[model samples]
Target: MAGRILIVDDVATNRIVLKVKLMAACYEVLQASGGADAIASARIDQPDLILLDQMMPDMDGIAVCKKLKEDPETARIPVIIITADNDNTSKINALRAGADECMSKPLDELCLLARVRSLLRARDMSEELRLRDSTARELGFAETPASFTPSATIAMIAATPVTAMAWKTALGNTLHDKVVVIKKEQALSLTKTQNIPDVFVIACNLAKPDEGLRLMSELRSRPETRYSAVVMVIPKDANNKSATALDLGASDLMIEGFEPQEMALRIKTQIRRKIQADRLRETVRDGLRMAVIDPLTGLYNRRYAMPHLARIADHAKTSGRTYAVMVLDIDRFKAINDTHGHTIGDIVLQEVATRIKDNLRSVDMVARIGGEEFLVVMPDTHLDEARMAAERLCHVIDDRPVILAGDKGNIAVSLSIGVAMGGLHVDVRDVGQLLESADKALYCAKSDGRNQVTFSRTAA
Candidate 1:
């Protein structure tokens, strides 16, 4: 199913009509007769979205939307206010009441589907972030997002400077957002600017032969501007253009010669949606970072290293190729910490991590498994190649002394590395046992000398 949608209307005919349309789109639909039933169904079913009727005898759609927004469990479900009122005031009121969209009676099926798909796309993204955040919180890896303030910037682009400036003036007078008139050439540069607009209002066919379509495609292709809300404006007669714009990744669309109040309401809704999307994107990034990274040195930590090693083992076994695992220890690391008071010790660890990372292949994995210990996994490697790689890593650490903070002089450092080979013929198929063999070799290297490489007997 694309998603679950709840339809709330006092009239049975309205519910049936919407349900049929939504079901044709392969969405699971739930019906409610009035506001009371709608609230109850939303609370219990937790649908992905709500198609709400504005005028209900028991309670109005605005009040129901407010109640849903207030409840933590239902707050995230998007609401689209469906009504007979075509006035700008009604649209603005619905937006202010936390509805994501407003559509009047005698709805156009094409426009209705476009809005539904866009809102559901936004909803799916938010739900994914929420699930990842929940897992991260359970693992004590979640980060608190910045407190949101109701501020946004919108850039308007049209065929002529006059039209662009008119839009700026109209939107600026009613909305609190920073509205600017942007040209076609300046559209791509917005990504480089510090104050990137939260939403872009594009006039379709602004340039010759539908140049606005090209601009929208360009913005969507670029990483920085891809997530910004794009609303395309088309002439009243260009119904086909509006649908194409939506399919081409426009978040919303408005007809040409639009009402100022209606434009303001739609733009405001787009801004709100963009802010929420931004928050979700950031939260998901933070969660993933925390799950795999070491806080001290910003390297992959043991929690991530073990599972990665197992994957390498599986690949080597399947391909009948050889792989190597190396355990490296910083020689006399505790002495350095004791002598330098831990602060300098931290600096040394960070520098060592950088050096090792810079010297490895992109396919290799290096992780900090202990205070002074690291695990490096290399796939598709032979015994000689593994030994040379280990030697190279040793030189990377010993060739240059790490400079310290506070004008402290550079300090010499060295490493002891132990390498163990694994493949279809190796006795160690389990990553734990492979690591154990490497550890045994590492102990030999440390015992023989502090700054050399040692290979496990299995390498013979």
Candidate 2:
């Protein structure tokens, strides 16, 4: 099935007709006879989108939409209210009640299907974010997003400056948001560092007919503006471009030229949805970063290093190049912790990590694998080069003394490193065995002396 859609109508004929249309498009259709039943089905079935009838004997579409928005379980699902009334007031009321779209009866099939596809695509994106947010919450790495939303900026672009300024003035009377008038060229030329708008209100026809749609496609393709909400305004006499607009990634459509109050409502809805999605994306990124990074030293943890090392080894084998792995440990870290307290020991560890990182090339990977222990993987490096690099790392750490946070004294620290070679004419193919070889060399280095570099016996 392409997606699951719930059809809510009081009349049996209306439900059947809508179900036929949706099922023909390969959608799994669920039907409800009234508003109350629709809400119940929405909560239980969790459809991806809902096609709601405006008038029902038990409850109106506005009341039903409000109820669904109030409930957490059904709030995120997109709802489109299909009504017989074609007045601007009806559309505004439905939008204010939280309907994602309001369409008059005798629906244009092309536009209706396109709208369905668009909303389903958006719903899928939100679902993926919700799943990630759930995972982050389960790991205790993310918190619920705060309710406060910052003021948004909306950019209006029209075929002529007069129309654009007119929109700005009209919207200014209703929307407190900053509305800027810009030419189509300026909108297309916006860069990432520039002040990008939260929402873009575009006229369907720019200098040429349907030129604004071309601009919409351009904005959608650009990384900097792709996430911004786009609303395409169609002229009253213009042919139906709603289907094309929705298919090209428009967030909403104003079919009947510009009505200030309705446009304001739609823009606000788009802004709220965009803010939510942006917050979810940020939270997911933070959670992912927290999972693989050592909070204390700001270095990649063992969980991220192991697979990364394997990738480097694979690349080396394919490119017929040799790579080096070094496992290093602080000399007598426990003694430092016991003598100077763990706080000083932590400072020493951070400084040592910084020194090791500074000495290596960008191609080299350094990670805090354990307490006072680190792993470095250098790709396309010879055995001699690896030995020299390890020795350099040892010297840098031993030469420097870590300063305590307060006016406390300094503490001298040193690290022991074990070097192992892999890939392209080396015997070790398995990552586990290669790591074990380095670990064995590390043991030898520790056994021989506290602060020195040792090479594995198998590393030619």
Candidate 3:
């Protein structure tokens, strides 16, 4: 099934009719006879969306929507309220109660199906974000709560300046958000530095018939404006374009003309949703970053470095070039911690990491593999180049003294490096074997004298 939809109506015929339509579209349909039963089914079944009847003997659609929004379990599911009343009041009330859409009775079948597809698509995206967030929380990386709400901006684009200004005035009476009137050309030419609106209200007949659809597509394709919500305003004679508008990524639509209250409500809903999606995306990015980065040193962790080194080895094999791996350890790191305290020891480790990073090329990989040890992989490098780079790292560390905080003085630091070569002339293909060879070389460096470089005889 494409998705699961719950139909809630007091009448059996209403439920059957809606179920048949949804099932024809490859959707699994569930039914409820009243508002109370609908809420129960929603909490238990966790359907992707709900299609609700406005007037029921037990409770109204607006009340049901408010109840659902108040509950955490069913709050995120999208709800569309079907009402027999065609007045603007009903639409505004339903929207204020947190209904995603309000449709009048004698529904247009094509437009209804298009709206269903759009809502289901949005719900699926939200579900995926929630799933990732759940995983992040389980990994002990919870997202920080937002401190404040930012004011939203809306851009109004119409066929003529007069129409644009009229829309601005109508929306201004009800909305406190910043609304700007712009031409089609200006809308498409927005820059990154300029203020980007949170929502766009576009007329379908801008300069020509169905020209706004093309504009919407352009906005969707652009990186800066792709996430902004768009509401297409269709004329009374152009009802056939409603499905096209929704399919082309319109968040909502205003038919015939604008009703100030209804338009304001719809715009607010779009802004709320956009903000939520943006926050979820940011949390997911932060979680992924935290998973592979060392918090103290800000270097790649062991989890990220092992796979990365294997990829470099694979590339070297295909290109028929040589690569080098180096295992580095801070000499007498534990004694430094015991003598200067772990706080100063951390400072020394950070300074050493910085020096090693600055001396290496951008293509080289460096990671914190243990408390006092780091791994570096250099591709397309021979034994001589690797020796020179390792020597350079040793000289750079021993040359300077890391300054301590407060009245304390400076402490000297040095590194012992182990080098191993692989690919082309080398027979080693296993990453574990390469690491073991380098580790043996590192032992040789420690045994001979600290603060020096050693090469592995096994691989080189």
Candidate 4:
């Protein structure tokens, strides 16, 4: 069943049409004939989704949406404005008033359903992220970052209470909204499950030289929260303190009493740098569009796939980030290619690429390195986790049969896999040696009649 939906329209006919559509989609529907009633229904029901009309007699949709957003109880609920006005002014006004999306009136059910689905999905993701943040604070892994916006995901701890508050304030300034005030001096309680926050701020001014040194030591000790972009803010007269922070592991430092504009400019520059870093990460994982991918299967070529293996291995050795590589061969891929020609072979490759991507975690990367060979790289995975992940991929491939327009009535394919633990060899040896170990395991699988995963047992 669809989530609860609230329909707010001044016109009876409009409300009727929306209610019928929602009900048909299995949504529990609530109706409001005007803005005041809509607000009341919103408070009473706290519906998952709202369809609000732009024009009303007493208060327009923008006014209603703004008031809804201002109230804590209603802020999380998504509001999609349904209006006759399609001009720029109305759209801007609607969004400014906190409407999540807009759909023009004389609504098409298909269009309405699509936008509603997207908004609801976004709402679910946001809620999950927020819950994860709260869980992090409770676990004591890291202190929550000050809200630059309520949606900012970074969490960090500081030695001094005052600087902790300032870091949060700076973080709050990072967001588009200034609505929420993150609390002060909360201890870090993040768990391993929490995603490493995007920004980490360590205020050197918060502690004396000795205490700050100890604090930095404690922070750098944690495995789960260490990958974040960390900033250390120091007072002007503390050379010893700043040096300790740098030595202990801080990414950037800012002196206290910098000009206001200077600080703002520096903060913006840091934000840009962080954003660029994220983009670079995506490019690296997805394989740069221009360089690595085969035009047919969305898989990486020789130029793209091995570099990640090498880079990941190097990162593991130098930064203590963990990694594992899995080499896979499509069993009897040649028979299908022989029977159906290159056209079907290309389709099978695309299907295999899709299977690999769909089965792996978002943190994992899978790339087709050859016509019938695929590679999976998983970062921060230990032996047990990597083995289980490979087993999962095997099952995913076993269960799904490729669907294609082919000369044969139907066809099915299977995969042979090999997984190597990073610490066993890759973390200590070079990337080429690491891949060789996994390839040895893959060769063993094919030797043993294919369709299984084998883990390397090399001594570190």
Candidate 5:
């Protein structure tokens, strides 16, 4: 079926242009001039896809996206943010707002149409799967009970650095597509991140019942993850600890020597008894994943950025150690995006995101919160140190021109970065504010002349 679409933009020209393209593709189209009307139409008309504008007079696109996502009725509807701005910060905000896609403005009609079709297809496919599953369950003979069924999904965390295949034996060796392993240490340390595992599989040997128990207790303590499960593997001889482990709030226990098939059976049995339990576990794990992660870049995002910022702030306050934030901007980004188009713009953003990540230390946090805008949370860095890093990033981006589509030549872009450091006035949330201050400095650099770095303050 041709999908219904909503094009939300304040610009009449852009709206008209989009309408023409969507209509040509046989989509039933709706138009909203700004964010408020868009939300109203979204709830009422329930369009299949929405093309949201980043900057609107009434409400910005990011705010609009968050509002829609917050509303249960409108939440599942996908939003694609369209903007002239191609800075990292703006892109970061869009993803954080749960924007399904981002398009830098001077829109490409073909790209827009293609994206619309793709999203609609995906939405339809998901709905079909859900309905089919429901139908199969109703016809009991046609469906295997979730326990013995290979289809039941369980959220798992392979905290032990073990391969996923091993977890299947107990968790359902059915080879679940969703099963994944994230480093336990990485997940644990990223407390500020949004993505947390549904169930944590800690080595009974490595993470003691005490440590695992503490984490499990904390997971259950949080209203968000209270129902989430924790699976622990203890030595077979450690009979005393199993009771203690369960008491501390572990949902399941595996001994050191569970065969693969046996392990899968245990997991399947759990799935049969309480499907919602698996769901609850997934909800928490997924929420944890979202909690501290920056959705787009896969870098440690806003959620995790807080504690690190505060730690730096604290270190700056107590010790003489200082850190700096470089508000980085892509030079002439709008032009690159305008001339080549947003798909290419997306490629550029990913490249720049990669380059910035590669150039940073493990101690640093790199985030894309906006279109073509980036923030580097540099711990123990002074303005000089931060400036040097900015300079390095600028050179790195400028050093190579990325190859883009449609015979588009290699394009090289420069960066304008603003530097700011911590003192008494800085709060953790002020990282955004600090970034803003640095952005102003970066703007100054751009205004003065592109291809250079500028500090937020003229004086120390």
Candidate 6:
């Protein structure tokens, strides 16, 4: 099933109709007869979306939507209110009550399906981010939402200056966002500038229906504007353009001759969604960075290195290819910190990391596993190749002194490397065993001389 959708209506026929339509689209459908049952089903079944009838026997859709929003468990599931009423007041009430969308009795199946797919995509993305956030919280990485303000920047693209100016006036009256009017030639330039719009309103059929569509395509293809929400304005008779816009990644659609109030509401909805998406994206990015990266050295940390070592082990075993694991330690790193201030010590560490990173092949993985220790994994490498690489890295450190800020003279630094080769069935094969071998070699290197490479003895 693509997603699970719950249909809530007191009338059996209404439930059946919606169920059939959704099932035809390969969605798993659930049914609820009234508000009570709807809330119960939403909490227990956790449906991806809910389609609610406006008028019910006991509780109305507006009240039901409020109840759903109040409950934390079901608050995230999107609700679409279906009503026979055409009054703008009804639309306002539904939207205020937390309905994601509102549709009249004679629903356009194309529009309905497009809205459904769009809501499901958004819901899934949010849920995934929420799950990752939960994991991050457990790991003590707390992520906060990005700051948002009512005064956002919105760009409207139209063919004629008159139409664009008119829209700017209407939207400006209703929204706090800074509304800017632009033409096709200037639309692509926004992608290059730092002042990109929070939401893009493209009026299709401005010159031609395809012009706005091509703009939408370009915006979605570009990395800068791909995540920004887009709402397409189409002529009332242009059903084809509406459908194509949705397929081309338009977030919302406005028919020609739409009320200024309704347009304002739609734009507000799109902006809120864009903000939520941006926040979710930032949270997930922060979580991933915390998991893998070392904050001080900007290198992969031990948390990321262990699994990578296992991957190298698995590949070497399966491909019967030789791989090398090296454990490196800075010589007398504590003495450097003890003699010079820790600030200078930090500069030295940063410089050492840069040299180590610069000396390795692109395929090699280097991670800062401890305060002064690093782990390097080289796949498909021979013993001689590993030794040569380690020697070069060692030379890079001892060759030049790290320059410090504040006119401090350069400080000499060196590295002691321990190399262990794997791929033989008889020798240390797994990551744990390989690390043990490398550690012993590292200890031997430190004992023999401060800045030298030592190879581990292979098993029979």
lDDT of candidates 1 onward, in order: 0.84, 0.86, 0.86, 0.66, 0.66, 0.82
Give the alpha carbon lDDT tens digit for every residue of 1-460 in model 5: 2677899989898888888888887777899999999999999877878999988999999999999999998887888898889555565567667776676767655445655665675455443333333323333313233444334334444435454446644444354634555554554454424544445555544444455556656666775455444666666656556656655656556666655543444444344323544433343234434544456666555544544555566545543446787778788889988987888888888888888889977557677767787778776566667777888988988888877667867778777777777765676556567767777887888899888888877314
Regions of model 4 farther than 4 Å from truth:
1-287, 406-408, 424-429
- At residue 287, candidate 5 shows an lDDT of 40
Candidate 6 contains a number of clashing pairs equal to: 0
Q: Per-residue lDDT for 103 in model 5? A: 68
Sorted on TM-score, best first, the list reads 2, 3, 6, 1, 4, 5
The Cα error of candidate 5 at residue 446, in Å, is 1.0
The true-structure Cα RMSD of candidate 1 reads: 13.1
Per-residue lDDT for 167-220 in model 1, tens only? 888765688778888898887876565677789999888768578888999999
Off by over 4 Å in 5: 1-288, 291-295, 302-308, 405-408, 424-433, 458-460
TM-score of 3: 0.64
lDDT of 4 by residue, 1-460 (tens): 4567899888999888888888897777889989999889888777778999988998989899998999998887888888897555565566557676565667767646655665565454444334333323333332434334223354444554454556556544435422221222332455677544555655564445455445545656776544445556677656555555655665445566433333334344345445544443443433345556678887666665665566556545643446788899989999989997878888888887888898777556678777799889886566777878888878877777777764455568888988776743344447778788888999988898887888776612
Greater lDDT among 2 and 4 belongs to 2
Candidate 3 per-residue lDDT, tens place, 1-460, comes to: 6677899999999899888888999888999999999999999888889999999999999999999999998998899999999888899899899999998898877888999999987876775566455545655665675967788889999998898888888876677779998888888999778898899999998888899999999999999898899999988746579999999999999985658888888898898888888887787567656797777787778876776677667656654667899999999999899998998988988888999999998567788999999999987677889999999999999998888889699998889999999886544358878988899999999999989999999655
Question: Which tens-of-lDDT digit does each residue in 148-223 have in candidate 6?
Answer: 5446678888778888788888765688778888877776776455877888899886687478999999998888
Error of 6 at 265 (Å): 1.8
For model 4, state the Cα shift of residue 226 in Å: 24
TM-scores, all candidates, are 0.62, 0.64, 0.64, 0.42, 0.37, 0.63
At residue 393, candidate 4 shows an lDDT of 78
Question: What lDDT is obtained when candidate 1 is compared to the true structure?
Answer: 0.84
RMSD of each: 13.1, 15.0, 15.7, 21.7, 23.8, 13.0
